[model samples]
Target: MIPMPARIIAVCNQKGGVGKTTLVTGLAEVYTQMMGKKVLVIDADPQYNTTSALGLSGPEFTLNDVLYGDESNNQKIFPGVAADAVLEVGEDWQSPNHSELGLIASERNLASRERDSMMAREHRLRIALKGVAEEYDIVLIDCPPSLGLLTVNALTAATHALLVSEPRVASVEGLAEIVTTIAEVQENLNEDIDIVGVVVNKVRKGRKDQDVWIEKIRTDFGELVLDPLLPDRELFAKAQAAAKPLKSFGSEAKVLRADLEQLARAIWKGSEA
Candidate 1:
């Protein structure tokens, strides 16, 4: 099974094209299909890549509803519970094990909220998630590639921050900024939160530079760098293109499925450590 007691992890990175969305969607698929865990994925990113990759559409009363509730029109954005805002996507990949997938789909309207200068914008997501934290074993929030209000909101609501990163000089160049943002959030927004670890994404084997940067991350963050680094594989691209989970490929991509299982184990114990 996946992590217990409901974990809200923001698989985030300030820079785009670093496999942020891929990791989030992939892990959700792993937890549900392999372990039969109830996983809730919040596609907080305006790009909505997670929604599309999972074959989900932006439904009515989406995350936009919670972020910009119309108090004047008596529109309760978090109607009773945040569970009311989620929709199950596609079909279960693993049968007889109760693998369930839930999503809070996003739309282009989500980008409009970026202009919102109100302080309430940062806490909007956290407040909405509180209404339904008890319903799932794990909740993954896919953040946009910017450390704006949306990212801060995810940091504020999250129990742990699972930073999606690459083992390269260019990728780690902005690591300082990411650290600063998380520090600010902890000092101001959520004191109980912690950065669980960093997942080095799509590490191309035999790259000497990758070895150098991998050592750098460990030296800088210590135990915060999660192990069993995910490799760059063609299967990842195929799975996304197929709009299906890695496990859905069955024996064709069994090795990819094993890689994801290792990732899940590393994240499952993150909260306690």
Candidate 2:
């Protein structure tokens, strides 16, 4: 059913501080460390939080150059070999907890892509992925917190999406708006694309506002919601600061690791269906 090379999932939310990048990094580790699958993470966000979270600085040819640079000559910045633009992370890289991860990093120049007058700008990402299709079992794109050209490009390239959101009224509205965009992209760009699941991140206990919106999200999206909800935890910050996953934090991260593993399996299983 699913066309292959990899199951590409765009971990996206057009709202900041919603744990979008964290989900991408977490799932990357889960697929690599836990499931023993290779993962290629596309840091499509100009903010490059995913690139930072993975403990990597910007590389020579980031997604920006691959997509928007001098394309009249070569298809990618790495000349004839596109996968060369994809850099593999070492076990010692940022004290990596998962070595089965490769990255198409992003940098500040990606922001300039929006102002580009190039044609079929949104299709560039899809083209780049195809160039290196044989290299990974899964691809995760961390989209920027906006429905801009970069996000649209990721959506067009992805087979499914994990829409992240905080549990709030505004967040619910954001989910609806993103779903609308997904529908449009499906109709016009990538018909096989879909929002496979909704991740309710940054959930706070005992907050009446959060409780109300959590119920609202479940009611509106129903079975699309994937659990268990990622709690607001301090270890997340510590792990990112250490350039490692919460699971790499050892015993204290048991609960965090379990939650992410569950979510990751849910995503892969959904892709199968």
Candidate 1 at 157: error in angstroms?
A: 0.7
Q: Which portions of model 2 show Cα errors greater than 4 Å?
A: 1-3, 71-82, 90-99
For candidate 1, the TM-score is 0.91
Q: Residue 32, candidate 2: how far off, in angstroms?
A: 0.4
Query: What C-alpha lDDT values do all the predictions have?
Result: 0.79, 0.81
Error of 2 at 40 (Å): 0.5
- State every prediction's TM-score relative to the real structure: 0.91, 0.91
Which portions of model 1 show Cα errors greater than 4 Å? Answer: 1-5, 71-81, 92-96
Tens digits of per-residue lDDT for model 2, 61-143: 88887776566764333322447578866343332344467888899989988776566777777876774755678889998
Candidate 2 overall Cα lDDT vs. reference?
A: 0.81
| Cα-based lDDT at residue 154, candidate 2 | 93
